[model samples]
Target chain A: MAPVGFRSVEVALQAGGPRRTKASCHTLMEPGMFIYTETPEIQKLRKNIVELVLTDHPLDCLTCEVNGNCELQDTAARVGIRKVRYPDGENHLDREKDLSHPYPHFRPVEMHPVLPLCAGLR
Target chain B: MGTPLRVVVDEMGGGFREPVKALHIGGPLGGLVPMSKIDDLSIDFESFASNGFLLGHASILSVPERFPLVKYLEHLFAFTAHESCGKCFPCRIGSVRGKELLQKAQSENYQIDRELWNDLLETLEKGSLCALGGGIPLPVKNAMQYFSEELKPYFSRG
Candidate 1:
């Protein structure tokens, strides 16, 4: 029988092409294309990215932080999104800084536990 | 039963053996699944979930809109309405309210306070029929709970 599976991370990454998945699900992706095999050098890069994103600056950069724990940095350190280019300005949202809440009523960022998706209003 | 709901379950013959049948089995999202493959005439739930090709909830949701946000409730609920059974007032009404509240959330409309959206939720939850009316609140409620920062501007003290 043909092996059937849930949509693989690799297949989704390929089908989405880039511009589609990049906007929302950046974290859920697997970065096997970035690093084919796990090596010592690759592991070190993964570690550094995790410490910076998850440990050192968990609440800081990246949009994924808002929905509680990030899947990207988690997987990055685990699988390796550490394929760094010196010229990595291909970052999607450059003008993200300008957008901000205007008034006195805005809430400051607060940390919280990640909640599971609702189990269908039951 | 008028017509049996087709359910497909795949079995791994390596030791674990369980046989299940479905008078009316459905996919994870309450959508009707096509039961194309049946080995011995009985539909299997475990097989469908385990080995069956995963259906695309996120992909289907993500298709109409560029992004899922406070803004896309209309698109989202459009999907729901077609999917809705139209049996109860709550589902029929709740889905309509979902579009409105989502729009309100997106535009920062009204005061974004308890009175406006809360009343809508209360009505839908208590009054709707079947699962559709009841289930309509999940996405809208999620946006309110999770995306409050985006909604801060709309809240009103008065």
Candidate 2:
């Protein structure tokens, strides 16, 4: 049975605004090769990368502490990024902390819980 | 448009164990919330930094806070990092300094949180670049503003 007054999330979202959304940090890396331009090349690469990382690939780690509790998967699905340039075993990253402070020193950078991805990596 | 956007939890590069666990240490605001904790929240610039945190596909997952000080400042950090005008000094130098101060506050110097942070924050607040740098102090400052007594342990105890 439906809730007392529940038509659909889409309806609720529409009431508010755009319910269709996603968590996309697109760099808009348009071949900075020039001064301005999203060059078809860069866009393609971006789309490819997006697809690869998102597919069946794990959004949160296998046993991540934030598992179902994670926002990454939700955002990714919203963005519809099911493909990338490569696969899970492809791109290398800033897996370790680049720098540290005297008190709360950190090693692995990509580790989200330690800090936000913005402070750690691209 | 409505409320804050969907939360963004990053299990960076297999960093966490699958079927992740949740832990909220920020007292009530941060205990350990699961996905079920969040429904569909509509977030726009209010929750976005526009610069630092929202670079490409990277996003921040927010835990609801009874007191918005820490959470909001947490949002500002990345924004300052991203929107930094690099125009004058404070925004540029101050934002960097703000990061340092945050590091200090979160440090082990439990004996000198006040004296240390007060000075550190004063500098960043006064000399930062855009509001980005200048604003970073709000979270910690506001925390101290309202919770200064709670934070006195770092100073008076010393």
Candidate 3:
């Protein structure tokens, strides 16, 4: 139940620690803590972020290459996202896909599993 | 008190009880049971939840026959939205969305995506982080289950 979103809220431990933290979620977490309460507020805030991001996102979940593997989709599912209320608000229709980015790309791995170990080290 | 009296009866347990079309026990998170089951209920958590009702604060709300369950649901959703902590996604956004959805049903000649709304409710119920988000669906489901005939008029195709 460690706050899900915040990674940057850092607590300097006397020992080793995680490299970087997502602040919103990390602020509520401690270095040595393995389990934290995922408060209702955190769930709501995270869900709101996803909803806001999805406003401009394309509605092509079915045809998209990422499809089931997409992080957004996964987050949405975790938050039980069923319907996007902002269908007419904004869309990604104008953004063209660019493949120019190189490999070894930045990926955000969920810190839940490793967080305890990192905190334990601290 | 053990005798099941109809809602129309004015006397109960030596107290004058007002006639109500429906009774809402356990506040907004609670279910609206038909008047027939009012006397049959026990003030216990297991019994209340087993009946799809909340064993919440034990607040009782009575609605007259003329009031619409859909309208009550809209107000309940709005109330929950205002009371939300502005945290977790499902409760924060879903409360507002739920209120809006119920409001949309109020307009004349509207087409509602019933399945979509149901799915939205399911998400909010399962995904929300707290009771505020998880409990909002109770009354709506109660209305759907017990009073669909009354709510049907609000959902006609545009």
Candidate 4:
């Protein structure tokens, strides 16, 4: 999949013959074009981006329900984010969980034992 | 575009009688030009860029000398946080974090960690999907650059 914040293009042509323009990860490479995938600048930017997201996120990975099965955890590991540099500030972690939905189907499967009977009835 | 900024403020806008500390040229996300540098700048994109500022929208909001620049910076952050579309994380969360930092500094005299501050700005600049997030750092950076003395108390000791 194309990286987030990057445009996905199947085919791009330089119809105007290459005037000055900004390039991103999806920009089509031309002959003799050189691309730097993991430069110091790129690494720093990637790390910083992940750190920013983690700054506001709760750091309760060890005790969280999805400890072993989380995409953010996987991405953080891949990016090598050993620590989040941002200081503790306003965050949504402490907000009361919204359990207001009336649908029991939205709850965990174990909590709704009659779900199987309903499915079989259907 | 070559017209002097002073002309824009004084001649066209009918100059203020009271002392003005800085001019927030352009809209809310625009860079702040301290009173000291107002005369030297011209109403152009390159001029603002060279001076570590931005001429976005070219609208001016004059800040009086009595007003605290930190408060102005806080307002900018608050505006961004409220206006963000919530599609992307960097802008959605970063703006709120920025606002919180400023609020703490204002209310509790908190000393912000400079490294963390820089990291937050960098993330917003590089990771955001659009200008709303990317361009915010320009004005904040301008204030930090031009009005460092005013903002000194808010930053932690190195």
The regions of model 1 sitting more than 4 angstroms off are A1-122, B1-68, B104-109, B155-158
Runs in model 3 deviating more than 4 A are A1-122, B1-19, B156-158
Residue A19 of model 4: what lDDT?
Answer: 31
TM-score of each: 0.31, 0.28, 0.58, 0.77
| Residues A1-122 of candidate 2: C-alpha lDDT, one tens digit per residue | 11211000111123334432111231221222222123343333233222323432344445655555444444345445553322123222535444544322222222223223332332
Report residue A113 deviation for candidate 1 (angstroms): 46
- Residues B1-158 of candidate 2 have per-residue lDDT tens digits of 44433323332233334443222222221212233432422334323333112112223333343433333444455457567654333344334433444444445452434443454454444433234555556445534544455445544333
- Every candidate's lDDT: 0.35, 0.36, 0.60, 0.72
Among incorrect, acceptable, medium and high, the docking class of model 2 is incorrect
lDDT of 3 at B35: 73
**How good is the docking of model 4, by CAPRI class?**
acceptable
- How does candidate 4 score on lDDT? 0.72
Candidate 3 lDDT over residue span B1-158, tens digit each: 22233332344444334556677777888777777676666766776777778757766678777787788888988888799774445566567767776677687455456765675676567555577878888878888778878877765432
Q: Where is model 1 chain B poorest over a 10-residue stretch in terms of lDDT?
A: B56-65
Question: Among all windows of ten consecutive residues in candidate 4 chain B, which has the lowest summed lDDT?
Answer: B84-93
Error of 1 at A68 (Å): 55
Report model 3's interface C-alpha RMSD after superposition on the true interface residues.
9.2
